[model samples]
Target chain A: MTRVVVDREVCMSAGVCEMEAPAVFELDADGVLQVGEPTDLAAVEGAVRACPTGALQLVD
Target chain B: MSTPTLDAIDLSERTFWGAPPEQRHAVFDLLRRESPFAFFAEPQVPYIPVGPGYHAVTRYADVEAISSQPALFASGSGAVSIADMPPDLNEFYGSLISMDDPRHGKIRRIVAKAFTPRVLENLVGNVQAVADDVVARARRTAEAGDGTIDVVADLAAPIPLRVICDMMGIPEADRAMVLQQSTVILSGGDPELVEDEEYMVTAFLKAGELLAGLMERLAAERLERPADDLTTALVTTEVDGERLSHQEIASFFILLLVAGNETTRNAISQGVLALSEHPAERDRWAADPGLTRTAVEEVVRWTSPITWMRRTATRDVELSGQHFPAGSKFLLFYAAANRDPAVFADPHRFDLSRDPNPHVGFGSRGPHFCLGAHLARREIGVAFRAFADHLPDLEVCGEPARLQSSFVNGLKRLPARLTGVR
Candidate 1:
């Protein structure tokens, strides 16, 4: 099973994760980044690389 | 028994718009023969009025002194030729190029960790491939019928534009518009392009908005699915327990897009011009392909696209032989300094083999010595080698058109004709 972690403190709500891998991450109503389910390891990995803040990591 | 009256050089009028090739070299020639270090009068901004006196430094030694000591001559003043800004744009100065220590240092560390030299070294083959492809296309276009190619459009434009896009993982479809927006945004001092203020303003805003949207989308995507791309690395890097904000990422993207494309493109276009003018030097490089690296450095000195950057003295300081009170303005001229006879032998000659060439084409030494220098050198050097090898008989078909911007002296259009089709 693939898992993901979004550092709440480091997440600047850049929304890049959501754009790159919507299934793995999304910004909350308050614009805070939140992790989602059905995480595709490759897609989530891509998002992890795309985040300018380095706030996301894949913990599979 | 008499002291020479110190006269400040008026590069403002000379370089107000882009200096023509002859005029550009003439100014540097004069600096080499006459005074290498002098003050430059403040360039007038047509509608905006703000007085900021600048002591221009032309000698390499003097420019080096100012650049190495950013504490003395800071880069936080927007790092532009014009000292004043329209209040609205003041708040948006967090980009790497415009920041001083601590903040600049912190941010640069994170970005550097992501785009390491090893990573850039890996991109060398890709850079060369892109240059080869672009040159091939230019040759094909020239052979098809027109028998003429605008070097800026055909040769100089694509290499950096595509390389940066690829590095950022930006889709190829978006490359052209991204390149166009970068050109529109950074052409700040060029009156010819900005003639229609309304058009320029609209384009600038639209470009910023487009970049912001791209950043947002990319940031969200990267957060979800980490990829092997610079944008992804930037969005994901952490420093001092603080993450970069969305605005920061957007600003970084915009800055890199403009800087990566503009500097490298100008280098390529200007490198071609340098080689064409110095046939012997060009022949030397062609004869021994190993000289590509040094040739790039020499071209950076020869072109030195960014002529001057303004700095303000925080505390009272003495530069060269003059003493200035606190808040004194200084303009460090990189182009003129590159030609100073003291630092470079046969400074006027564009020697491909010129070494120990500690040219400040990027910027003076210190905290802000061009974060993108490595990438630029790779792109420019590889591109020059490819052109020289493939288009062996390449020559400018007509008088190259100058980009009507003093800030970024590049060819707007370089009409060229090649002997044999690639």
Candidate 2:
């Protein structure tokens, strides 16, 4: 299983990750990002790669 | 096809930029294939003295590598201009894009708070309303005239301009002045936009002062009575016990005015031109509205509205198999990188359903990646959805009058016909 990890320090909250994988990554009203366990590895990988700030990473 | 000699290509010349789009692409293709780290002299602008040349980083891998490492490739020296700008000009024009962290990071964090998904979600209705009004006005113009309209002016330019104005809470009376000032600031030495090249520096300074002045007044007003607008949020919001000063707010507002207003306008204008050129892709998008997401990404990739950004080497480094000393200047050509065959399949083709499209239309993965990328994407998607809904058969009537500048791949005028309307 691939676990999604977000480096909050690096995430600028551009919301690209949320757009790519809504179920795995979500930005709250205050713009704080919430990371959930990944159900779809492909979508989660896309979100990880699409993050502009290199904020998201996957840990096995 | 025969390969052209390095001497045959002169990207520094204005004539090179004014050349046909295909010709420019061919030059970049050759450069990407043969010499991805080619160096060229800086273009001689009117007031700015010609300085050191820049290595044109054309390949996708090179651009991504350089951008990902901000410490190695610094932006504080200057990011927007090849020549080092004067101190005052840098302060006025630089803003967040021209700084290194922790300054860039601090300001970005505070400003990023204003651009949260929740905040942007609130603006969706405003964006849709502006797009609808723009399309409706274009329909009226096409109906009243010869079924033709200037897409740049009628359809493309107004949506982002008005949306930014509404977001910043600028008065209706001041929006036109804001637009005019921003056009002059980002005109990129285009003769039509910045007439009288002798006074180009004066024109830029005057425009900057006017916009800054306008924002300063608004910031003061927001301070007295906080409102729900971006300016108010910017003035009041504090991060790590640091709040943006009035001057910082003014500079940021100017950055937003130019970055938010001009780049998205070009994207929409160029998107219309692209759709007109590729009717099949247009039909594909029109048939499936779900394609708006990828379609917007394709438009940004294909158009590459802001062609390139300059980054200076902070220290000696090796990049893409090339050695460079400290203080080396490199121009990351997002336009060329987007079309790199190594990264993209059939790089020239406009494929709307392009998934896994990691195009750096908004710079590569880095701290300096465009802060407004999400907003720009939303604006482009909304604008095209309006087109698909109202003018399904819209197409460009003639060749577009291109903006004569290497910095911005823009259209001064795109003659488009609303065929479905009449």
Candidate 3:
């Protein structure tokens, strides 16, 4: 299983991860994104590729 | 353009770029009416209360004064809105935008070696090739009639992204990722697109990590086999006999990415919009390709894409009779300054022949003048020339979608149709 980690403090909220991997990285009411369980590896890669801040990481 | 008294004007509710059409028209009307100077006080802050330090200068002369004298009005404190910065991330990414002289001069000199006019001229050939390819692709799509192109997407966005990536020695496979990162980083203030701060921060950090890794590898590679690319140059070069740390180098790369991408993108979009709005100007360039250079400058001036930069005062400073106490933040409005009627006759009109055009579209004068301006000029010139030669019949197919962010508001979706492609 692949897992995702996000350093929340540095996010400028540009929304690239949510754009690329919506299923895995969903934004809550506070507009903070989290990696849900059963993360999609391809989508996670897309998220990683899409992120401008480099705030997202994958753990396999 | 006569100067206005303080009692005559006020800051409008709308963010300059994101203002509604009527409000937009009204704002410019007020600008023209008020002439050189207008005072703007900040409304309630959103996330954190931006102290009463928020004030604005909308006149060209006032902006010129502030920008020219970086000693009086410093840019090193930070350029973005204060409310947006998180506490922890403030000190880490130190780019040229936040540096004062001596240090600013030293780093600027070393980095300047990479972006010299000669280097920019050399990069012109590559810029032309990439621009031609992009315009050709757009032309082909536009030739299909209903195949209207989004100038922002098809032409404006990719060319700069590709050129900067190429200059940095980023791999072809990674260009898409680079583009993605550029968009995310550049669009930080856009409310519509950027919804998740945590995700954005996480993504931002990850990009830094990835690029830092890339920089480390590139540094090693350059040590073994130096190349002509900027990455190799930066890795090898030193400022004041001190080599740039990995962190500083990454910050520099990140700065180039932001500066190069959005500014050039807006220049292309805004240039297209200008020409489309003025078919005669379009025909002028289409007829005489030589005018593309002048046209690019005029478009940059008219668009004023990066808009204003915020500077925090270190001591009580008197600018054009306005007293800003130490720690007061002043937003230097470059867009309005670019359109100052006293400086340019018929300021709003896009005249290609306007020479002696000392427009401060690239951040007025001294300290924070855009480092990537030469490359930006080349990219805009190349892109416009290619478009003029190829997509002569291009027309806006739909209302261009506006990016919501005030920091770098530009056309996000510029749908267009074209003809005359064989």
For model 2, the stretches where C-alpha displacement exceeds 4 angstroms are B1-4, B420-422
Decide which is better by TM-score, 1 or 2.
2
Predictions' DockQ, in order: 0.02, 0.61, 0.01
Ranking by TM-score: 2, 1, 3
Candidate 1 DockQ vs. native = 0.02
The CAPRI quality class of candidate 2 comes to medium
Per-residue lDDT over B1-422 for candidate 2, one digit per residue giving the tens place of the 0 to 100 score? 45557778878887778777788899999899888898898887777888889999999999999999999999987888888898668766978888888878877766776676557878899899999999999999999998999999898889999998888899899999998899988887788988888888888899999998898789889999988888888888776786876667878899988998899999999888888889999999988989988899999999999999989999899996679999999999999999998899999999999986889999998998888887898899999998998888687889899888888888889898888767
Residue B265, candidate 2: Cα error in Å is 0.7
Give per-residue CA lDDT, model 1, range A1-60, as digits (tens). 667777754554545466467766655544455677844777787777655556677765
Give the range where candidate 3 chain A is weakest over 10 consecutive residues by summed lDDT.
Answer: A9-18
- Give the CAPRI class of candidate 1: incorrect
**Roughly what TM-score does model 1 have, to 2 decimal places?**
0.81
The model with the greater lDDT, 1 or 3, is 1
Candidate 1 local lDDT, B201-312, one digit each (tens)? 4656677788778878888898899998888877887668878876678888888888888888888888888778888898889889899867888989888877677677
Compute the interface RMSD for each candidate structure: 13.2, 1.9, 17.5
- Of the two candidates 1 and 2, the one with more favorable lDDT, higher being better, is 2
Model 1's chain A TM-score stands at: 0.84
* TM-score of each predicted structure versus truth: 0.81, 0.96, 0.78
Q: Is candidate 2 or 3 superior in lDDT? A: 2
